[model samples]
Target: AYMNEEAVGKAIRRSGVPREELFITTKLWVQDASYEGAKQAFETSLRKLGLDYLDLYLIHQPFGDVHGAWRAMEELYKAGRIKAIGVSNFAPDRLMDFLVQHEVKPAVNQVETHPFHQQVAEQQFMVDNGVQIESWGPFAEGKNDLFHNELLQGIGAKYQKSVAQVVLRWLTQRGVVAIPKSVKPERMAENFNSLDFKLSPEDLAAIATLDTKASLFFDHRDPNMVKWISERKIHD
Candidate 1:
């Protein structure tokens, strides 16, 4: 897997955190997205992570035999192999179709969400339909000079926080769950500390203005991009 689940498993062991205290989530990748494939892939990921059960399992993308994949996931969830099952990068229309076809409502929809792509409408749709909207790129991967945004910078200054913290606070204020990427211990601490301070109404409003309402990254719906992502073979 791209994330190297074996290393993650080792780290979890080293941390000595109790399994019950940690919420683990993993995804089904593009190649193994059919009913049979998903079942095997889930076992593979579970083995790599050294876990008996997953807190959540997500279909990594909207491509492939998603219905088949969901059927497999639904079975697993009902069987208690996964506590919850969801999808990623699924637009409202596609999600609606899934809701119509499947009895299980996707517990969450992971997507590209940041100040740049606020996904206001999408989030509302998910909220109404009882699905959580989890953000994938809360910092926009530092794209568009996010670290140096004057608006976020100014807000952070008021709270003695970094721009990264301000963005995370903004997302949290909007009821969006952000999963920001961090490598070093210091950065991870900084990300966790973002929840320490509350952004004022004015600050939240200012951050709202930063929404471009479009993805800073490539559109998942674009034909060429979808084709490329759908065809990618990350594992055997």
Candidate 2:
């Protein structure tokens, strides 16, 4: 139950891991960003996940009644319904505004990050605020020939790891927590294998040079993109 929340639940149920020992996480979409909406949406996700307590709960986007939602999140935190609260896709200015205004600091900040669009400045800002940086599109969604990046390929060859694995290791080495999505169990095992090998400082520096300062996905800094997303439902 608690762990078997979706199709993935069946696999977790088979893994024999106890529910209490697992750190469960799920997101609250922008459509449900309001006070009442957040309350109702969370319950639905809880029901879907069969989770009694979410290890982490995040605002899917920085748009909408975020301040109001944050208040409700603080209330939830105090009541122990959610163990931790955070925001996803929030840039420095937006994060700063909320951090300065909210009573409870967010434990994490999930962002669109990869070697191509590495958000070093934002990550640094989050670090300054004691917020853990989590990567959303850790592999860049295969955009910009991420698999063919010569630098990454060379580094991967050196470690006997795939470019994807090398990228995940680079993030972990930078103290960033990554949640790479892959519906395949073999790929999931490969993703988790990053913890085994450490990236050298030289390798870290080389990968750092791959940053192009642009997002393959929507740019949160763009007002038009924000407006478009704000108007649409989460998957609409």
Q: Which one wins on lDDT?
A: 1
Please, what are the lDDT tens digits per residue for candidate 2 over residues 1-236? 12234755565577789988888888777778988878887787777766667889999889889988888888988999999999988889989999899999899999988998899998999999999999988999899889999999999998899999999999988888988888899999988887789889899899889898888887776899988877876432
Q: How far is candidate 1 from the true structure (C-alpha RMSD, Å)?
A: 1.1
Task: Please give each candidate's TM-score.
Answer: 0.97, 0.91
Task: Please list all clashing residue pairs in model 1, or write none if there are none.
Answer: none
lDDT of 1 by residue, 1-236 (tens): 47688898888889999999999989999899899999999999999999999999999998899999999999999999999999999999999999999999999999999988899999999999999999999989999899999988888889899999898888898889888877899999999899999999888788888889898888888999999998899775
What pairs collide in candidate 2? none
Model 1 poorest ten-residue lDDT run: 1-10
Backbone Cα, N, C clashes tallied per candidate: 0, 0
Mind sharing the TM-score for model 1? 0.97
In model 1, state the lDDT of residue 50. Answer: 93
